[model samples]
Target: MAVPVPRQRDTPATESAQATPPAVAHATAPQASLTLLVIEDDPAGGLTVPEILDADRHRIRLRTARNLTEAARLLTQDVHCILLDLSLAGTPGGSGPGAGPGTAGAGTAVADQLAILREVLRIAPRHAVLVLTAEADAERAAEAVRVGAQDFLFRDELDGRLLSRAIRYAVERKRADIAQYKLAESKLRAQENARLERGLLPNPLLEGSDLRFAARYRPGRSRALLGGDFYDTVRTPDGTVHAMIGDVCGHGPDEAALGVELRIAWRALTLAGLCGDDLLSTLQEVLEVERPCEEIFATLCTVDISPDGRRAGLCLAGHPAPLISRPGRRAQLLPYENSGPALGLLPKARWPRRQVELGGAWSLMLYTDGLIEGRIGEGRERLGQDGMVEMINRHLDRGLSGEGLLEASVTEARRLNGGELTDDVAVVLLSRTDG
Candidate 1:
């Protein structure tokens, strides 16, 4: 986006009123100091560029480079403009015999010097370039401008006012180019991040079931796409449906990456015909290897509902138990006795799976701790398990189900806390009947 126009002295006819060209335009407004690099081969300093004193006495700072080698070393970001001599072609030591154009063997040297100019342009594409050449060689001067220079100046007519004006224009152009490039890069990065977030969060896969899945997750880290909360559901080969939700500790790209690793492991283990303790034990090993630190852990609740829709086996690893409610029945916590520590805590922790006999028609809710830990009042005590059950009973009385129920619970949690949740929350509902 930053297209730097180099300077070249190659006009077909003189544009100045007299035999010499008029002074280049000066900045209408005062501007900041600028660093300029003058690349020339005249060892005797035959080329008299403007000093601090222009014909009108405007001051300008200047640095000199004899050839491409010096220019390369001085090509820092601070250098605003480069005045390159068309004759001094390649790097100093690298030049061999026959380097210059006029000499019987200088043809290669001339081409090499031109190559040096090309390389300099490649390196400092953001800086303005000016080509200095003899007035007689108008053809090469025009060619130089065509190559990359912004404006060309004849050595014989060079003065303070023209050089100063050229430097100011070059710097302004470079800044515009940089600004445009940054804006384009920002837009591209935002688009890519949005695509990734979509893949990470997906709609529930329970199309045929009466279940309603609702969830909300926000990363504790700033400007992040996803945290470590993950959930998934699948109907097995035998028609039994399995569902799970888990939270990896911390809010970081590493934590999110680990969550993906564990979720994929859980799916693979489930489809491979592993379930209950065996599936979870292998998952613990997976986390032990994949987690960024030993202190990292994950809490998970997995539910395997039978095809008949009358029974389900719930497994917990340091996770809150799922809440259950039947038509005309009070909501209560599912049996959570003998649960195990979260993954990556103990080398051999045991999670005794609990079996619950769901009615012919009932709804079950599983969630991460973020849902229950919000404050109910301006006090230390949290909503906790009991508070959540009471909240669900009230919602059921209003006949809320599926997405509506999940939305109500989350909205109420925020209201109780008086702010957004600080931790990630994931909720999944499984129902056996529409009633």
Candidate 2:
């Protein structure tokens, strides 16, 4: 490392040496200053590098390390690439190439020959590496690439121009490879999230039921489709329609998954003929078991519409009361007296179900707090339940109903909040047009 290193253009090639590509350097020369770290037993003249200029005609700075220890000390973020000598003997210990460390001496010849290369890769996972070996060891040079090296170079074929070009090429190729890997990983994650979102937002099992159903859902997390909000609607065999909306304590993945579980359990329990306090108790039990933590709880509102589609049994577990909008009457909150504590909070909580009369035609709007808790404007004032009622009245005056009404309400909430809401929102509309 202390001796005079070979400089390609300055050093005369032997008559038997292969001709080097003079144009490769000009094409691959890095635009900015590039540092090359050379690790070898003898950098004094093992390979040409001292005063070797890059293809850009800029001087390629060089750092020499006699061993792995010295190389690590010199390995800095500024080091763009590494030129490792494959023939370099193992460190004083039998821990590197030429000396076996982990495995026995059976068929580890390839591993042994590339031990130093592997060590370099371990220490510098981000650095572009180029292996220096004899031209006869072509297969091993390629194996080094498969082992995570950026590229490999033969000592006989290496010159100032070839080394410079290889360095630039290896660095760019490594960068491209990293970008490609991230793109692939993002695609896989998006696919998985899509599948989860579909499971969370289930299709209502109202095939033979006459009640109309519409829902709007949005997650709080950026680039996320599913958060802590969950909802489901299903019709029992007896012709009764069951709809439920709930929000977990947190918006993290654990909370979102738990919400989905509760919604599914509610649907299953409803279809199994469970209703009123019995259904609510079973749901609370499921929440206690499925929640990620003891402190985590969920606010839920479940309504079971009678077979006549005019009356519904309402149960609020620390949730907002549903808004009832009739043909000739103003929209208002339903009776929420004696509502029980949120699930996972009380051990033997009793959610008293209230029988409500739904005249001839009515629209029951069930939603989580996310819809009304958003800031009304830049001020600290929120679009609370009162504000939500006024907003709904305005939309209704415009004749918006079903999907249009839900979409407009949520859109207006976001606009009033100044941007996207910080919490997940889930709204469900159960409308019956017949008297």
Candidate 3:
């Protein structure tokens, strides 16, 4: 025998009614219309749902499922909310259609009821859910809400207006929950990217060296902190400062990761006293093993400055030559003749180290090709090495040095192209001042 319970009425006078109507009104305007799915085993037609209208005066569509199996089939994207009857059999034992094995106590009816709600939650994780129960089972109804239902309803108090309002409120609340989850995920990703940037782009190791170092790096990918271009400057114990700049073949995370690996490898090998062709050869081996494909390769430019700061060793492996500027002299590119093929391209490649005289008080700029790949205008003409040298000369004439020079150069390059360049750009400047 079923005990008849007092019906609970949610009206303007009730506290629950006060909080729900405002949310329903706000959510209804944007949604315009909604579909509600009702799951119940009552073939006797004990439940009656009247015609429902949203805030926009549009009818709310309703679908009924005799069981969870049918409910799963009807649970499409258009369905915004689900209403499940708590009296369905087999819910406690997890034998109910589409329900996982029950982990709840088997004998208690209350546990069974909650288990049904849990199954519905598992099935429709994204959709808002409500439970229908006897008016006397108010405690169980509240428990259903705690178990993940958006709201619960007493069958005796059910009416079209109340159910419609509850549906709108539940859908809006679910949407807000999803939005907050995504916001938190985005913040976590940002924090992770910051840590990754620090690891990938380390500070220059130039202690005890009189040379001044400045660098500029910009990834072609939108909203990226690192790119395929990588550079590093370190002064070893031998009083020789090693500077390197390189570019992987593509503009993506994989390429950026490869660039970081190469940079770290270069630093390790440089500190270990490897130089010229030997250093380049070891880096090529590393690339061949770590690269995703055989076709991937990287262009490299390395400069080893002498202890006296009056000379340097330059090595170019299928990369552009560095620009050298001295006081009262025009900026020009270091000779790139007799350069070896890019890393991972030629087997047993020999990268010749060219010793060049760096007169006192000179600045050397080593860069990736992205610096010169920008177009001069909307036309097909690129800002070639000649144009870049001219631009640097103009900036130098204005007394811009160190970081200011690199910033002005990159800014002017972007301005000339009328927008951002489509490749990763890295420019490193090593300057020495004589007392």
Top model number, TM-score: 2
For all candidates, the clash counts are: 21, 1, 0
TM-score of each: 0.65, 0.82, 0.80
Q: Please write out the lDDT profile of model 2 over residues 104-170, one tens digit for every residue.
A: 5524555554666777888898888998887887898898888888888888877887888899899
Task: Give the better candidate number (2 or 3) by lDDT.
Answer: 3
* Superior by TM-score: candidate 1 or candidate 3: 3
Ranking by lDDT: 3, 2, 1
Runs with alpha carbons beyond 4 Å of true place in candidate 3 = 1-31, 68-73, 88-123, 136-143, 221-225, 397-401, 418-420
Q: How would you order the candidates by TM-score, starting with the best?
A: 2, 3, 1
User: Which tens-of-lDDT digit does each residue in 207-294 have in candidate 1?
Assistant: 5665545565666466777778888887776767888889998877898899888988888898888889999999999999988789
The local lDDT score (0 to 100) that residue 265 gets in candidate 3 is: 97
Lowest lDDT sum, 10 consecutive residues, model 1, at 12-21
Tens digits of per-residue lDDT, candidate 3, 1-435, equal 222111222211100001224535665444435888887655455667777766565678778776666677888898899888887643332234323364344345566566667778888999999888889878888888888888888888888799889999999999998899899999999999889888889689999999998999999999988899999999999899999999999998899999999999999999999998889999999999999999899999999999999998989999999999999899999988999899999878899999999988999999989999999987999999999999999999999999999999999999999999999999999998876
* lDDT scores in order: 0.74, 0.82, 0.84
Better of 1 and 2 by lDDT: 2
Worst lDDT run of 10 residues, candidate 3, spans 11-20
1 versus 2: better TM-score goes to = 2
Determine which window of 10 residues in candidate 2 has minimal summed lDDT: 11-20
